[model samples]
Target: MRRLLVTGGAGFIGSNFVYFWKKKCPADLVVVLDALTYAGNIANLDAMKNVPGFEFVHGDILDTKLVERIFTDQGIDTLVHFAAESHVDRSIHGPDAFVRTNVTGTLSLLNAAKAAWLDRGSGIPHRFHHVSTDEVYGTLGPDDPPFSEETPYAPNSPYAASKAGSDHLVRAFHKTYGLVTTTSNCSNNYGPFQFPEKLIPLCIANILDGKSLPVYGDGRQIRDWLYVDDHNRGIELILEKGQAGETYNIGGSNECMNIEIVRLICDLTDLRFRERASLSEKFPKALPAAGRASRELISHVRDRAGHDQRYAIDARKIKTALGYHPKESFEAGIQKTVDWYLDHENWWRALMDTLCFSKT
Candidate 1:
């Protein structure tokens, strides 16, 4: 079994990956390192606490000493690096954190892994898998083809720029130092346990609370939506059978305009709320009212600074090479996502107080 160090294991996608890993390889030693930043919630990892072969360490990836210690102490054979300041609006307002965490933090992880896993003949064979985003390809015209691995870096936002830098660093490490590295650039992800700050969860929470569902500009920005579990499964596949020093693009093959996504969530939430309300007369009428009032709650706001208009991934390489394809269609996946938020009220209630930080 592989001994893996997963950074950012307390955040949305990372936590999903952690759960996926535990279920698939219970005997593997999985050590999670997270900074527990505003977006990182310990509750995301609550299910793994009692599971054997799993350990969580609350720490920042930028801490060189601590990262190196974990690498050496745990004999970490694989590094799945995911820690970063990922929100676009936050990056625009405070880019220093993005650069510090995404670029410098990635550099630190690469250095530590190189130091610990060099000398493969005498040490365990190791792999450094860097998780990244498709925003690094910048915006696309409505007719532009989906982004492929060869797409040149033209990141428009600070968050995307910082990730681009990290991607380049991983490539440099593989080429210059002969480090075994693989990187995956994925599209927007949505699923359960996602921080409410993101689009899907934010809309779900606001719809539930009767708050205005804010849409940026005309809300026509297009994004390919990947189910979180599908993305995690692709990562697992890469870790198992992928060639080192290669990059993979993981996508959901589901593309819709931003407004379309919000509308769908509204329709789904309304249907669910109506079903529940019919069962109990004591249930608040406002709940059903607000659910039906979803479309009216849609509000158009100023667009984000330097917001990319569109992002879509062409994931054929992974599909052709590794037989990896997304299993969830947008229709089914979104219904499940909305139902998850509705059923897990207590899980997201604690996160609602932090909504002010999620400026879209």
Candidate 2:
């Protein structure tokens, strides 16, 4: 059986990928290494706790010794790195942790991978796949085209800067030491199991609680949205077939402004609950007062510092190379995501009380 090490496997995209991988490749041995940080909740992996081929280790990627041990003892044939400090607002508050986790931690993993593979001699049959974001391309204007694999690095926020640094390290390792590495830069991802701090989840949670949905600035910042499951599929395809030392961009071709996304969620929620009330033959107390729509909950807040005006990805490379296509539309994906939050209140509620979401 092939052994794979997936870092940050307890977080949003990472966890989703792990779940998909386990089902798609049942014979593969999957080991997950996570720090269990505020954002890394073990609950995300609760369903797979007893799976035969799954293993979980609570640790930080910065721990080189632990990483090396995993690579050595597990005879890991593949590495899918998704660990990083990814929150932009948190990076703004303090960049030290970002640098440590995103920059230094990546270097640590690369060093360990190189050492382990070299010790194993020629034809190690190993591949290292790095997961990254398109924010490293910085912002784009109205007429500017989407970012591609060759886009120059122009990161803005501390979070993006740290990821950019990690991306460079991965490239250098591939060029300098002949490490078999592949990197993927993806657009924004939204779906189930996301912490309630990000834009989509935050909006859903606030609206459900009857709180004002905070929109940064005028809420006009644009981002390309890729469903989490679609992204997971793309990562799996890249890990299986992408050429070493090559970078691929993954996007959904679904671009929408922040305000547009918020409004769509509000309308979906309103319709969903309205129908629920009708079926139950009772007035829905959750609905806003008559004549008041959920859109009234929207309140524009102060803009974040160095907020990227827009982000879009030219995903032609992944599409052409791997024959990958996203299966979910933005409207369908957002409806499912909102309905997920509505049904799984206990999951997010436990996280809010335990994790430091207030800081996020």
Candidate 3:
């Protein structure tokens, strides 16, 4: 059984991976290292608290000493790294954190993994799986084909650039040092426990609060959405049978415009709470004014700086090579995601209330 060190295990995608691992690889050991930043919450892993062989370390990926200690003490044989400053708007506002965490933090992990796994004479077969994004491939035209594993890196934002740098480091480590590594560049991910800043969750929360649903520009930017669970499954398959030193592109095969996604969320909300009783019972303080549909809350905001026009992934490589496929279509995935946020009102409400009180 493998002893896995999952960095950023408290974040959205990371936490989902932890749960997936528990179900798919229960016999293996999982050691989670997270800094518990604004995006990473300890509560994400609450369900796994009592599970055997699952350990959580409240720490940062930049802490070289702590990382090395875990590598040595836990005898970690697999590294699944998901920690990074991932918000594009935040990166545009302040690029320093993105550079530090996504670039420098990645370098630290690479060094520690190398020393513990390669430098030692124990001769253990280890794997370092680096999770990356398709944004590093840059924007696509309306007629352009989907991005493949061979796409050139042309990151447009600080966040994407930092990730691009990290991807390069992982590749270099494999080429120069012959480290057993596999990287997967996935498309946009949406599911439970996502921080409110992202598009889907933000829209959901805002609609519930009777607040404006801010849409950037025309909101026509296209993105390929991969439900979190599907993405996690793809990663698991890659880790199990994927060839070392190869990169795979994992996508949902579900591409929709931003405006379409927002409208769908609005419709789902309206359908679920068509009655006054349901609306009052759920939101209490944040009900839409009487007779007003949630779609009326849409507000066209200024476009994001250097936003990409479109992104699509050619995931045939993984599909053909590993027989991997996403189970959730956009229709099913969006409804399930909305249902989750609706049912977990207290969970997200606490976070929203804390932020509001802190601001005041």
Candidate 4:
């Protein structure tokens, strides 16, 4: 069994990956390292705390010493780098943090890996997999073909640019230092344990609180949505069968407009309220409780600066090379997302309160 070290394991996509990995490979020792940043919630992994072969360490990726120690102490042979400052607007307002975390922090990990695994001829069998996003390819025209592995870097936002820089670092380390490395750039992910700041979760939280649903621009921006577990499965395929020093794109092939997704969530939430009488008591301010439509709260807001119009991933490389294919469609994924938020009220409610997100 592999000894895996997953950074950012307390965050949204990372937490989902942790769960997916442990269930699929129960014999492996899984050590999670997270900074517990604003977006990283240790509570997300509460259920897995007592599970055998699972351990969590609260720390930062930039601390190269701590990372090296983990590599040596835990005998970590697989490094899944998911730590990053990921919000676009936050990156625009504070690019320094993004650069420090995404670019410099990635470099720190690479250095630590080289020291522990390669230095002094230790030569431990190791794999460093960097997780990235399709935003590094920049935007696409409505009719342009989806982003392929050969897509040139044209990152639009600070977050995307920082990620692109990190991707280049991973490639450089592999090429220059003979490090075994792989990178996967995934499409938009939505599913359980997602922080409410994102589009789908934000809309669900607002609908339940009877708050306005803010829509950016004309709300027609298109994005490919992959369920979080589906993306994690792709990662598993890469680790098992992928060649080192290669890049793979993972996507659901589910392209949808932003407004369309909001409306879908609205309809789904309304349906949930209708199906369950207890939900009305739990969330008294919910739109369905007042005989109001969730869409009625949709309000147009100013568009974000440097917002890319669309993003899509070709994902042919992974499917062909590693047999990676997302099984969940947008309808199935979003329905699961809606139902998750409905059933786990206390989880999101506590997270929202801690983050102090304005519901009004």
Model 1 ranges off by over 4 Å? 119-122, 278-287, 357-360
**Arranged by lDDT, best first:** 4, 3, 1, 2
lDDT of 4 by residue, 1-360 (tens): 999999999999999999999999999999999999999999999989799999999999999999999998999999999999998878888899999999999999999999988885686789999999999999999999999999999999999999999999999999999999999999999999988888989899999999898888899999999999999999999999889999999999999999999899999999888989888998999889877789998988888888899999999999998888788877888999999998898888887865434321
Clash number for each model: 0, 0, 0, 0
lDDT of 2: 0.88
Per-residue lDDT of 42 in model 4: 92
Off by over 4 Å in 3: 275-277, 285-289, 353-360
For model 2, the stretches where C-alpha displacement exceeds 4 angstroms are 120-122, 278-291, 354-360
Q: Residue 180 of candidate 1: its Cα lDDT?
A: 92
Most accurate candidate by TM-score: 4
Per-residue CA lDDT of model 1 for 1-360, tens digit only, reads: 899999999999999999998898889999999999889999999888899999999998888889889988999999998898899888878999999999999999998888788843437789999999999999999999999999999999999999999999999999999999999999999998888889999888777676788899999999999999999988988998899999999999998999999988878877876777642243243345543457778899998878899999999999999999888888999999998887787888798887555434
Any runs in candidate 4 off by more than 4 Å, and if so which?
354-360
Candidate 2 TM-score versus the reference: 0.95
Each model's lDDT: 0.89, 0.88, 0.90, 0.92
How far out, in Å, is residue 161 in model 2?
0.4
Cα-based lDDT at residue 294, candidate 2: 82
